[model samples]
Target chain A: MLTIDSLTKRYGRGAPAVDDVSFTCAPGTITGFLGPNGAGKSTTLRMLTGLTPPTSGSATVLGLRYPDLPNPGRVVGVMLDASAQHAGRTGRETLRLAASLVGVPAARADDMLERVGLAGAERRRVRGYSLGMRQRLGIATALLGDPLALVLDEPANGLDPEGIRWMRELLREFAAGGGTVLLSSHLLHEVEATVDRLVVIGAGRVVAQGALADLLAGSGVVVRATEPDRLAAALRAAGVTAAPTGDGALRVDADAETVGRAALAAGAVLTELRAADGGRLEDLFFSLTGAAGSGAPARTEVAA
Target chain B: MTATTVATTGDGTSRALPEVPRIPFSRIVSVELRKSLDTRAGTLLVAAAVLLTLAPVGWQLTHLTDGVPDFDLWVSSARGGVALFLPVIGILAMTSEWTQRTALTTFTLVSRRGRVLAAKLAAAVLVGVAVMAFVLAVAAAALLVASGLEGTTPVWGDVGSVVGGSLVASALNVTMGAAFGAAIAQSAAAITMFLVAPTLWQVVGTALLGDDAQWLDVFQAFARLSSFELAGHDAQVVTSVLAWVGLPLAFGWVRALRRNVS
Candidate 1:
């Protein structure tokens, strides 16, 4: 298990980049680190990997502080800043060098290259590799030691659709094999589809942390109906809230079955009746951070 | 029987998983050396050092035959070759990490930053020793050919000191280069400073201090250390070695260990 305890990092007394952020990711799970630009996702990852020292607090991997660990490369496979690679080295050579550093056999490099689907292009220099290819090479390098824990910062940044699919599957497979995986990404939709648990940060502090299901439990679903006034009345009677959407339809925050039944009971012709995908998760994110559209809702820290 | 067998097999398969081997430090150093050696620039630096050392010795062999055949002559000739080429080799070694972006891969594998620096320094010293040996061998061969023409015996003691001094000087130069690269953390700037700093120090010292200016020149100090000549002067050879080599290296180490890798 990876435990980050009260991790606080401040740059020159500026606002803490990562403030009192605490979370645990156990083996057999993929934890998605969600945050906006400049939200300290990268900084937090750097501190965890011991690339940068935290102003205060600590992160332990497998119950040992990063510096105290006997063999760090064997325990934690980190791929922070995917662009941190030599342009002159070939994809295969890069992994080979990394494996050698971690004291793994050279043959493992070829295996990892094939695993990341870069087998064909392993001989080609990294400078010639596309952004997606570089990302794959980075992943291969990370897996050279067959680490127990994986920490990736924006691993999906430059990936195409097919590459993203492969990455999602790869991460899931890694997690399934009883390894801890913590990935940070700006793609909320992808995170929603891939991760089981999430730690969402905003303006440097973790605003939400739990299983995706638990966080979305009280976050009511959106229901759209044609007969606006009648649907609103029915939703109120069913102890649900409804607001008129831009398209002149009542958007009710209730389950689809209840809203459909209420529309049927009200004898209102339902042109469209469906629950939206929990208000786009992004909207919930904005609302949680008080960073919604102009004149955002008054800042209220949501108690997790 | 088939149903019972399948149930038992499924239950047994879920018992446990085998362990994976852990990587060791020796492998890390070996890999670092391999990657450093594979580069085109690395090959060129070694080739240049070899050629430069042999070319001058080869020319000297073809010409002069009047002086006594001595290892001091060979040592001096080899030192001349090293004085010209080793600094360039040193610059290449230090800047290659940054220019290639290999620093990222290097640091990631050996996350303890200090170890990575240590490994690079060790590799550089080994290379410096090898290059010095090559220069000495080539110079000896050239002198033997000259001695055959002149029918004279060669002095081995002077040859040994020359080779030893060249090796020590080359090692110091390489270490200085690594330290400079670490402190500056930029290839262009580090290379430029490595090339120009000593010359600038020499010129400034000569203009200001007159005959005693040698004491102020960094290059002169380094040369004095290599020649073991500092008794007559106020500054000790030990002090010169420490100032030129030790101070810069310590500063570089601090910068490398503390600076955030960009």
Candidate 2:
């Protein structure tokens, strides 16, 4: 299990890059750290891996602080950025070096190369590899130690469709094998499908966090019917607010059963009547953050 | 598969997980060596060292009369390879981490930032020593063959001084390169500064200070560390060694340990 307590990091004395953030990830589960661009996701990952020190707060992996952990590479596997590679070394040599540093056997390096599907090109220098190939090589390096926990930032940034599927499967398998997986990604749909729990942050502070099911459960409901106006009126009378979703449909804050009963009671002709499942998680994310375009979420200071 | 069958183990017993061992230093060194030696630039540096050593020896053999040249001049010329080439190797080593974005992978594996830096320094020092040794061997062999043809033996003391000076100079150059590489974190800029700055200082110092230039130039201190006399003045080799070699290395170590990898 990984526990992050009141973690805070500030570039200056002003707003922090990561604020008073706290979360935990248990073994045998995939936890997603969700945020938009510049949402402090990268900074938090860096701090967690001990690459960058937090100005305040603390993070512990399996009951040991990062620095105090015995052979950290054996416990926590991290792939912070796929771009972190030397162009001069070959893919095979890259993993070999990591394996040596982490005390893993040289043979394990070849295994990781095959596992990441870079076997044929393992001898090729990293400079010649495409972005996606580099990312795979990065993941292969992370797995070299056969660590108990995995932390990755945007691991799926440049993968193809098939590669993405393989990555998802790999993550699931890693979690199933009793390893904790903490991954950050801007891809909401993928997160919704892959993560068992999620911690969403905006402006450097967590806006919401819980199981995926719970987050979707409280997203209100979307109601669509033939006589939208009548249904809206009925919902208002029933103490439930309804609004047009700008798609010629009304989204109501009532469950499917409640909306169904209301629509029928009001004799409204229904062409479409179903709960909106709260649209997509992406819409909900935007609603919570309220940050558009290049506007970063407000920064909050959290103590580690 | 019933709820009643699921019992909570409240006895507070914990099982220990299997331990993974730490990687050995020999493997670390080998891996670091492989990573560097496989590169084109690494190959180029090695070639440059060999060529630089041979060219001077060839010139002295083909042009000089039938007498052994000053052992000091011969050794000094051979040792000059470190001052000329090791910095490029150092720049490649340090900037390669950043340029290739391998810093993340490196730190992730070692975790302890300080250990990685130490390993890098160790690798660089080993390479520098090895290259200096190779140059010395080549220079000795050349002098032996040349003496066989000329019927004159080379002076041993001059050869010893040249070897000692080259060893120290190579160590200093490698450390300086590592320092510059860490501080700038860019291959092109760091290598350029290593090559350009000293020459620029020498030129500007000569132009501005004339006879008084000796006291003001930092490159003069480095040149003194080389024990290579220029113009008519003798350089304070000891002071040069302390300032150029000692300071840059200390600065690099501190910066590497403290700087954020991201």
Candidate 3:
């Protein structure tokens, strides 16, 4: 299992790259950590795996910090970047070297190479391999220790449809065997199909997080009223979260029926009341992350 | 705790789990050595060092009448070849992790970066020793052939001093190169800085302070080191070594430990 407790990373007194981000991924499931480019997904993963130290808070695997773990490679397989593989060594040599470091039999490396369908290409140098091939090799290296948990960053990038499907199946099989997988990706639909849980971030803060279905299914209602202020106040009084999604619409954290009842009670004329999720999870993803945008969030909103 | 020990689970509860073995220093050293040998660049460096070592022997064989065909001449020639290539090889070994973006994988596998660095240094020193051994073997063979020729004065000048000093001097060169590599991180920049910056300093220093500044010259000290005759240059050797090798090494160690592998 993996847990991130209010982890924050601020470089050189600038705004925190990852601001108070927290989430947990359980065994037997895949948690998709999603964000746009520069949304600090990689930074968060780096901190989680102990590459970059967090400014505050903690990220741990199996209730132990990565560095504190007796042998992290034996417990947590980490692939922060596919492109980070050495370009010099042949694919076979790469696996063999990692195997020796991991104290596993060299045969395991060959097995992994064959498992990743890189058997024929094992003799080729990594410099000649494509980006997708690097990802495969990286995955093979991560699995070399036969770890209980896997942390992959943008593992699906540069993969063909078949390769992605293979990876999805691989992750699925891993999770099915009581393995915990925390993967970060900006590929919405790809993750939407694979992940059991979602942790979406924008501007270094968690915009939304929950089980995949719960986050996408009627998360809240988008209500447009003649007096949005009155409706928002009523929703707030009812302990329902409400935020202006622009265009005179309030994104209310309640079902349509509950929202309708609250609006009627508030005596606010409702011209529009619909589920906030216009389509599938993409709409919710866009709505939640789009509002925060990228880079630094509005300071006034952060202060609030 | 035994190999089978209790570990805390993610749910804030303790459970029994098998303790896997730590990545041993020996394995890491082997890996570092392999990292230095497996690449094309690594192979070429060693091959070039060998060729350069042998090239002088061939030339000396043809131009035998010019000088006494002695062990000193052949040993010194091989030492030059090994010393010249040793630093380049060492720099590549240290900086390739950053240049190839492999530090992420390396550090992730073995979280304690100090161990990796220690392995790199150990591996580099071992490579230096091994290369020096090869150089000596070739030098001895060349000396034997040259001494066999008529009118050639057979001279093994201070075998202990030359062999011992050459080993120490070559190791220092490689280690210094690694320190520069570690401090700068980028391969090209680190190599350029290491190869050029000190020479420029020596030139300017000599121009300004005359021969008095030779005390601060690392290159001179290392050259004199091969003779193992520091009658009056002991302090100079120590001072130059401290200024050139020690400072950069300490700074590089800290940087290696603290810098985030991106």
- In candidate 1, clashing pairs total 1
What's each prediction's TM-score?
A: 0.87, 0.86, 0.86
TM-score of predicted model 3?
0.86
**What is each candidate's DockQ, to 2 decimals?**
0.31, 0.38, 0.42
Question: What C-alpha lDDT do the candidate models reach, one value each?
Answer: 0.71, 0.75, 0.83
In model 3, the runs with Cα more than 4 Å from the true position are: A220-281, A288-304, B1-17, B66-68, B149-154, B224-226
lDDT of 2 by residue, B1-262 (tens): 0111212133221113336555566656666777678778788888888888888888887876757766566666776655677876666676777677777777767676676666776788778878988878877777777777887766666555577767867776787788777667788888887777666766886898785655545555655666655444445444444455456667766777777888
Q: Kindly report the docking quality category of candidate 2.
A: acceptable
Kindly list the per-residue Cα lDDT of model 3 for residues A1-304, writing each as its tens digit: 6889999999897778889998888777899998777788999999998888899999987678888776677888889988887788899999999998888899999999999989999999999999999999999999988888899999999999999999999999988877789999986887888899888788888877778777676457788999988998989878889889878898877789888888888898999988766243566456546665445442211111
* Candidate 1 deviant stretches above 4 angstroms: A216-218, A237-239, A256-274, A286-304, B1-28, B64-69, B78-81, B88-95, B149-152, B155-157, B209-216, B229-235
Candidate 2 regions exceeding 4 Å error are A267-271, A278-280, A288-304, B1-18, B21-29, B70-73, B151-160, B195-242
Q: Model 2: DockQ against the native?
A: 0.38
Error in Å for residue B38 of model 2: 2.2
Indicate the worst ten consecutive residues by lDDT in candidate 3 chain B.
B1-10
RMSD of each: 5.4, 5.3, 5.5
Best by lDDT: 3
Q: Candidate 3: which pairs clash?
A: none
Better of 1 and 2 by DockQ: 2
Lowest lDDT sum, 10 consecutive residues, model 3 chain A, at A295-304
